[model samples]
Target: MKPLHARYPFMAGAREAVQEASVDLAEVVATDEDVVERALERVEWALTDGTVGDTRRQTRVELLSYPVARVIVSTVDEHICTRKYAQAEAASAHERFVEELETETELRSTRQQHLSLDALLAEFDLGTAVRETGDGFRVTVGTYLELAADQWGDEWRLVNRSLVDGEVPVDREELYVLLKQAIRHRVVDGLPLSVPDVIAENLDEEVERVRETLSNMDLTTEIDTVVPDLFPPCMKHLLDQVQKGEHLAHHSRFAIAAFLTNIGMTTDEIVQLFEVNPGFGEEMTRYQVDHIRGDTSPTQYSAPACATMQSYGDCVNKDDICEDEINESHPMSYYEHRVEEADDDELTDWREGAGEDGDDDSDESPD
Candidate 1:
């Protein structure tokens, strides 16, 4: 990647400004300058924040994300006290910001990046923005409010009326809080990071060289009971497919059932997942799922290796996570490595606000 100054010129431009103290009204008669420039305090805070590092951080990339996060929410955005910008200008600015994000050299490598919001909302299943304004785009708030009211009652509806009507002004500090969250999210997601085209060709060549080696990574006897929180990318893909009622290849089905079985799912639950398919046969599906769970075999069947999964065209999201973790030949090895990391105090919560035990994991103590 090019230097940060080159990639994000806007961030490079947030230089220190000239500082001068303001005159205090009450103290003006008593003292020449009783006022302090709070800007100086902000500058100091930024400096302190920019330099502080968690010595326990696993990678330098994670440390780098801190400053990038600050830049995304602070250096790059212009704060308006009110929704006073022109609609056309806001749209233009939004477009430019997206282009910058799309081109970010470091984004793809950082981790939680997803399709840009516009791209995601472009699909009708997600629904189109009901009303567009200079301030922001919003989905059909009526539908949301109806659902909220149904779940929480009429008081929830009353509270959301201001939000739907734009009567309640957005608290500026709260906006900053949300902005920081969004910037932090993009950083953690590894948005927009991709290999340079020149290097991408080299990666393809290199991956091809090691592709054959993957076939031998299959596992037979050594299987670990990995928790769902630590499932490898390919396994997660299969789980998602089944949940969506998509057709799974034979190997994919076996791998998924074996995995769910290992993680404590019963034969009936596995069979139920397949019942959504057209022309579903409950008896046949039950038998097949039970067979994979090893009811028919002397020993339990284990999930396939990454190489075998690759042969099934299932290893599409490989970020070389295995190589980064332990260079494990099998997917189970990756799962075990994640489980170890997930046990650590500083690294355990991979899913936002979710605990290893499948409960809400709040940083705060309950009152």
Candidate 2:
């Protein structure tokens, strides 16, 4: 396998490279310990860290592990796992490509290994759909609509963009953002592969390990109810912003969505709460929410850290609990601390007054 294949295993060229090698996947799974271990790490790290972990020095091992990892995820046959694995691969590729573009140099130690921006665009059949402009690049409106998700933030909304002659213009950074979506689309395409019986039998132990880890990470049953009273100050601020029908940037939306999901709010409940937002699309919102909660995919997301919230300017209305050094490190921990200290009467469910009439003074969603 080539170095580029190792760096970007999702690219079409990499797929061709693998095919040409004619590697025996079954034998590799059974005998090649390094390939198997790397494959397992790919799934585990994707599940836990949203990364594919470090790039191995061995190009061959790294390239081979991509397919093996796919087999393992497919064997698990869990939608959430498949989604998480695919997204993690794409996210990792994006980071590397961004670095390469910024520095205008190869990220790999091997010379002439990194792909150029033009190469990347062509590999994905985007050459015709995207074109360069004086300020930056413009993507055909149809392609833009296909790749951009409104839930990504208000910025990705078509109305917020500069449209000219059936094309939408984007700066270098914005184009990369779109590329990330494309990469994700490519990685997720044809996932949960129909693994041969031989390969499946050989990977039983590795599959079991991943399944066990997935079981521990399941969030659906972990949170039973949403308690706004116990929410961290930052989360409270975010929830309040959403309730007011204000626009949240992508990170802010993710922060709030993840916080709510982890706190036990159902997808429908979150959707109802967000209904007040202008241009609300129920289908899109629910899919994004379900994706975050690992309902439709294998990647469950937790709320960002205290530092991340502050970085995005979403951290607001800090309270005494937030000032506590030990208790305020993470939003989840803050909520847990409040829950531990609150009396039964002090802990009220947010759903209590969320009735059809919406008569309650509290911030409740109407039926």
Prediction RMSDs, each to the true structure: 20.2, 14.6
Instruction: Kindly list the per-residue Cα lDDT of model 1 for residues 298-354, writing each as its tens digit.
Output: 667776777788888877577666667464567766865565344223332222222
lDDT of 2 by residue, 1-367 (tens): 7888899988888889988988788889989999999999999998888899998999888999998999999899765577678778988988999987777343344566667889999988999999997889999988887777512344565665667888889889888878988998887777768999999999999999998988798444343346786788888888888878787788998898888888778888788778877656789789888999888899788889898888888889889989999866788778866765665456545664343223333222111
Q: Model-by-model lDDT, in order?
A: 0.40, 0.80
Clashes of 1: 13
TM-score of 2: 0.63
C-alpha positional error of residue 25 in candidate 2 after TM-score superposition, expressed in Å: 0.9
- Cα lDDT, model 1, residue 331: 74
- Scored by lDDT, model 2 comes in at 0.80
Question: Stretches of candidate 2 above 4 Å error?
Answer: 105-110, 221-260, 263-367
